[model samples]
Target chain A: MATSTTRLPRAVDPNTVNGWGVDADPRNDPTYPFRDRSREDGPGMAWQRPPLQEPRVEVLRSIEHSRLPAVVGTSTPPKGLSGMIRRAAFRYSESDWRHWLMLLGADRINVVEGIFEDLARGRIPNIPAEMGARAEWRHNKLGLVRKVAIVAAVSAVAVALLRRRGRDDW
Target chain B: MLAAEYRGPYRMRAGRKRMPRIEHPRDALVRVTRSCICGSDLHLYRGMVPDTRVGMVFGHEFCGIVEEVGPEVEKLKPGDHVLVPFNIACGQCHFCKQGLFGNCHEANAEATAVGGIFGYSHTAGGYDGGQAEYARVPYADVGPTVIPDWMDLDDAVMLTDVVPTGYQAAEMGGIQKGDTVVVFGAGPVGIMAARCAWLFGAGRVIVIDHLHYRLDFARRYCPAEVYDFREIEDMAVFVKKQTDSLGADVCIDAVGGDAAGSALHTLFGKAMKLEAGSAIALHWAINSVKKGGIVSIVGVYGPTGNMIPIGNVLNKGITIRANQASVKRLLPRLIEHVQAGRIDPKALITHRMSLEDVSDGYHIFSAKLDGCIKPVLYPNGGQ
Candidate 1:
């Protein structure tokens, strides 16, 4: 009943949102969920045969000997989609584009990281009991840290401006 | 050193909830009084175990106090200080009784088809790990070890892993009263392998590692000759130069990855006397033998494959034997050596730590992995 007459803040124009960037629904807008396509088969079945021993033999052959050393000690800084694009450009070739590679790496790892965070948090959302039962998990690299940082920084800025006006209103 | 929980590659978070308690009736609750982050643990850390759920208590090498026991568990009681054998062997199994505990059907069945472990993958049978406040010890009578109150938990912890593993390597090495042996990879296990080689009567023990720290230890602590691989490029050329260009009587690839393998070629490149990868002692035993020589493997292998040529393996006419070390059988002897001061797997213990300092423990050690050989953790120092 209190919702009957409550005033709402005006919505931001889509053209002006986040510096006029395209508002793509990252979770489901066609290119979302990061499907490999090579692995899709109806719904649930994603697990391959599990290793029978300690040294997991076949971990992504394409990511051979050198790929491991690629992101050994990394930390990412968030700068939005444009920032991510810029970082990827830089990593591929030397130019004003180098920063793009960092963004790309961050963006790529972040998408994977977000879905993975729940598992990292030990939520154990309806999986084979044995999956969560093991002793180790992967690590969060610089990318997720960057995204979280950007979110924090944006919120902090928004709060600061509202405070400057000396009003509780946004 | 750092046994943080992981979700997959790049999804590590600080665990907030206290890890779960022993849930099953057959479980034996053992607080991880002493544990270490194993090299194998990194695979899970790297996200190889897909479906890897979060909140994994990561660690396996440990010695602990019996905090609680399952209702059916009559062999152990509280206050008993013990070492957890890396694999949970069901003493009732055929292979377990025959000393092939690693392949015991029940033991392997319980661990990701490979059986239960302290802190390992679902493949090892999804038992929760010991890296946290506690672990659920399955097949209790068979895997939980009994150590004395006087023994340092650090030394006892090796019985859970490298001590037996190293001794098993020597036993597989099949050394007579006197023989020449060369072991690759001076990581803690390699050093221990060399030490055990000396104990097994290797007239000449040569250890190979790129790290100066480990080779220096080998030179100073053990009687084995040391070969710092950083100085050498070719395995055959380097090893041969060391043994009058004849190659070692037994060559052990304590080194993982490219130690003996050339992945680019999908075959063995320059021939070395012995080979070891998925099975370090076994490769050495099989290929690096003296026509009738024995090779023993005690290294760790996950799902990775060793591109060994089986025909050549047979043609070599050598003795090859490797498996998960029979930890229970080897522990008592390893303890006697530790007690007798004949060997100090403890000296291999370069990092001494407590649970609170795990971050530093994981880092400094993880940073210089090959350099920071063995680290021992103690949760409760009371004992």
Candidate 2:
């Protein structure tokens, strides 16, 4: 692996920040805590918008990144590929997501270790372009697999639809 | 990193809230000079993403001056004016070490679990972004691109996301010398992708979008031929004709989210296609490629749910690469270019307003008013 590259030379830690507290501000007037009261028709209560979220990054830093052990039996919102594969829009299988994780060489343990190490010592890339090249290759490789799967799925659905249409005509 | 968060889903108030701060010792506080609005910010406003807190400051693409540094910081100084990469990475992590800052474990850890961004959500690590009087930037020394005194922060800010993202798209799409590359979207990112594609030495870069204004923008700004996907049919054929009857060697879906990806799904259908959307770009990426060609995805994906067909990838010899746009990868060189006046991303800006007029600017951008492309906010300009 190359030493680290410096796309940004003066990045900082956000964790030590404070006072950006719009949290319960008088700015919201009657609805102090919640902002964006456009939908203020919630009857007596303020209809505030929720915060933008993407906790997958934090989860990836956890011990159980790829394997979700059910978050203490309540099913933990079904994280990782298992949960995502269930969505109809994505059209991917569980194994596919797993394969992608591996293909990208991303693992929970490694991710955690890498983050700490990078923080411990500022990281710089020796072959920065190569890194992008690798992602390009990975995305391309995964895209190929996804296309094939979608084609097969769509083909099956098309054939079934045709059969159902024929039966209906009968 | 303390993100000067733009809390969407919630009406944004014009003020700086520095609630979130750096937890690690390596963090630094940044005095932001310039920040730009991202198209993705619209998603949060529309509530497509869930649970985004209202107090989140909303700047993602920005460049600034380092006001303070951590004890462990080695590469930066307090006075250095720098561009902050959208994703904050420590630069030495396996992914960071590998130059994939988009997937930087520390940067997107929380968001990956929930699929989100700065001021976007707790799922996205809830980092403070640089849309304020002061932004505490994370991974300070690693990702900041020092803007030479001669360089403009407005132009330098492009190094944060759009420009690098655009270049990453071209690289992912496998643009080769003299190859035709089709970018599906003429939004700022799409335009940047075209610009980057041309920069990568591609021949006849083509861009597609529904907006005439944006298409016209691409025709005027990008080095590629432009097409209107809304008015056209048989896109593959049209693109192929541009490539001497050969399909585009590379396809980039700079369009993001389910809507954009779904539009692509309907257009390409089940045929051989390629994509570069948010989470769903990988789905059609393979189908659009020319046999062994490539698809490049640069848009940011939401939390963990992504489904792509894998079997065809095995059959068709196509490859799909994605652009996380490693900031560290481009910082030095991008800074050099900016100082040299070779690239100026600020050309995308068409609207400029004070921090107080952000609501009006947002309205203009939201309505696509008067060919509004990129809107620059000057928080310090007026009372």
| Runs in model 1 lying further than 4 Å from the true structure | A1-170, B1-3, B10-14, B17-19, B48-53, B110-113, B244-246, B257-289, B309-311, B356-360, B380-383
In model 2, which runs have C-alpha deviations exceeding 4 angstroms?
A: A1-170, B1-10, B16-22, B108-117, B258-286, B304-314, B339-341
Q: What lDDT tens digits, residue by residue, belong to model 1 across residues B1-383?
A: 22345444434433443544444444577866778756556445544332233445567788778888867677899878888988766665444555655554543321222444555643454455666566667666777877876787677777787777776766666554335677877777777777776665454677766677877887776655676655665555654454454445555545443343343322331122122123332333344344444455555543324445466456756555556667876677667777777767677777776655455445444445435777666655524
lDDT assessment of candidate 2: 0.54
Report the number of backbone clashes for model 2: 120
Q: How would the docking of model 1 be graded?
A: incorrect
DockQ of each: 0.01, 0.03
- Native contacts present in each candidate (fraction): 0.00, 0.03
Instruction: Encode model 2's per-residue lDDT on A65-150: one tens digit a residue.
Output: 43221111010222334333222212333223432333122222222343354457675322222122222233355654675689
